[model samples]
Target: MTRETLDRQLHHIQDEILLLGSLVEQAMLNAVQSLKNRDRAAAHKIYQADQDINEKRFAIENAILILMATQQPMARDLRMLAAMLEVNTELERMGDYAKGIAKVTQRLGDVEIKIPIQEIEQMASIATSMLHRALGCFISENAMVASQIPAEDDQVDRLYEEIYRQIVHTMIENPDLIDHTNLLLWVAHNLERMADRVTNICERTVFINTGELLEMDTTDDEEELDSE
Candidate 1:
């Protein structure tokens, strides 16, 4: 392919990645809303949308692979291709987390139990926001913004901790709510994991911009600081 054609294909792949990001964000939102509102139809919708997310991801990956094989991209172009592949995988996994939350919702069924899901909702909010910003950084190739995105994961982690402790206490206080609380905890865990996948996308953004495969292990540093 010509240079212009190659660049156009790369841009197309980037656009598809952004599209997938938006779908995953919607899935996360719907999954959380389904849980919060006890809407089975909404939960099922997320599960169905996950199929589209998976299909789109594979299509983009195949396009990138073909471009790489036929064009023999230079170092910079190769970096972008590699970043796209990694980010595509992360986005797909985030979609899976959303599906996982949907499954939890299905398991909950029509139980009229009222347990506070506000913290899980907060976790989902932060995670989806991180995902949105990460995609923007990816599209803009902004290493600085990408580098800062993982820091927000710290807030998600804290919310996860709070949810975990609260759920455990609730389960302890009311053994009957053990199943309900456990399911909600799993939902929170899925949202937390989705945020972690967004960090992976941010790392890919940094890699594409700087051509450096740096591991942004901020959680370890945060733990140490907490200990100190």
Candidate 2:
């Protein structure tokens, strides 16, 4: 393929990745909203829509592989295509986390457990925002911006801990609600994990730009500072 044609195909694939990101972002937000509202129908819709996320993921994968095979992308272009592949996988996993939240909502049924809705919503909000910025950094090849996004995962972690403590306290107060409370904890865990995966996408952005595979761990940074 000519350079012009290759560039065009690359742009098309990037657009697909953005579309996939938007879908997963919506799924994450909708899943939590469904839980807050106790809307089983909405939760079920999110679960079913996971199939569409899966399909989009594979479609992006197929396109990338075809480009690699036919275009024989070299150096920076090859790194980019490879990073896109990884980002595509990470986005699909985030979609699964969303689906997992929806599943938890379904399992809760009609149980009247006291959910930490505010904290949970806050976690989702921060996570989706991180994801949005991560994708933007990826498209711009802005390693500087990508480097800063993972630090926001610290906020997600603190919220997850607060949610966990609240749930545990509630479970202890009412032993009978253990099962229902555990499901709520699972939802928080899903959101936390989704935010962690966004850091991985950020790592990919840095990789594509500098050819360096850095882990970007904020927790470790904190530990080092404390030791110093």
Candidate 3:
């Protein structure tokens, strides 16, 4: 294939990546909304939608592999394609986190317990926003913007911690609520993992740009410590 054709294929793959990102973002938000409303029907819909996300991820991976095998992308182009593979996997796993949240909602059926809905919603919002920006950095090949995105993960982490503490305190006040609170904790944990995966995507963005595979989460953690 000509270089022009190769470039066109790569752009098409990038657009697919963006589409997958949007789907995962919506899944995360919908999962949390279902939890807040105790909407089992909506949660089931999110769970079923994850199959589509998984299929889309594989489709993107297959396209990248075909390009790599047939076109033989070189240097930066090869790196970009490889990075796309990694980001695609990360996005799919984020979808699983959403599905997990949906499962948690289903499991909590008929169990009335106080949920830290506001804190959980904040976690989802921050995580999905980080994911959105990380994908933008990927498409633009902006290592600088990519590096800045992971730092926002600290916000998600803080919210997760608050949610955990609140849930534990409530459980202590009413031991009978232990089972229900544990399910809520799982939701927070899923959202936290989603944010962590966004950092992985940002790392891929940096790798695509500089050919340097840096552990962005560790760097962000060290920066946080230094600030303290």
The TM-score measured for candidate 2 stands at: 0.95
Pairwise lDDT winner, candidates 2 and 3: 2
lDDT of 2 by residue, 1-228 (tens): 469978999999999999999999999999999999999999999977899999999999999999999999998999999999999999999999999999988999888789999999999999999999999999889999989999998899889989989998998999999989999989999999999999999999999988989998657757857965
Is 2 or 3 the stronger prediction by TM-score? 2
Report the lDDT tens digits of candidate 1 across residue range 1-228: 459989998899999999999999999989889888888899899978999999999999999999999989988899999889989999999999999999988898987665458888888889999999989998889989888988888889889888888888888888987887788887878888888888888888888877778888566767768975
CA lDDT of every candidate? 0.87, 0.93, 0.92
Model 1 spans with C-alpha error above 4 angstroms: 221-228
lDDT of 1: 0.87
Model 3: residues with Cα > 4 Å off, grouped in runs: 219-228
- Which ten contiguous residues of candidate 2 have the minimum total lDDT? 219-228
- Name the top TM-score candidate: 2
lDDT of 1 at 87: 92
User: Of the pair 1 and 3, which is ahead by TM-score?
Assistant: 3
Best by lDDT: 2
TM-scores vs. true structure, each candidate = 0.93, 0.95, 0.94
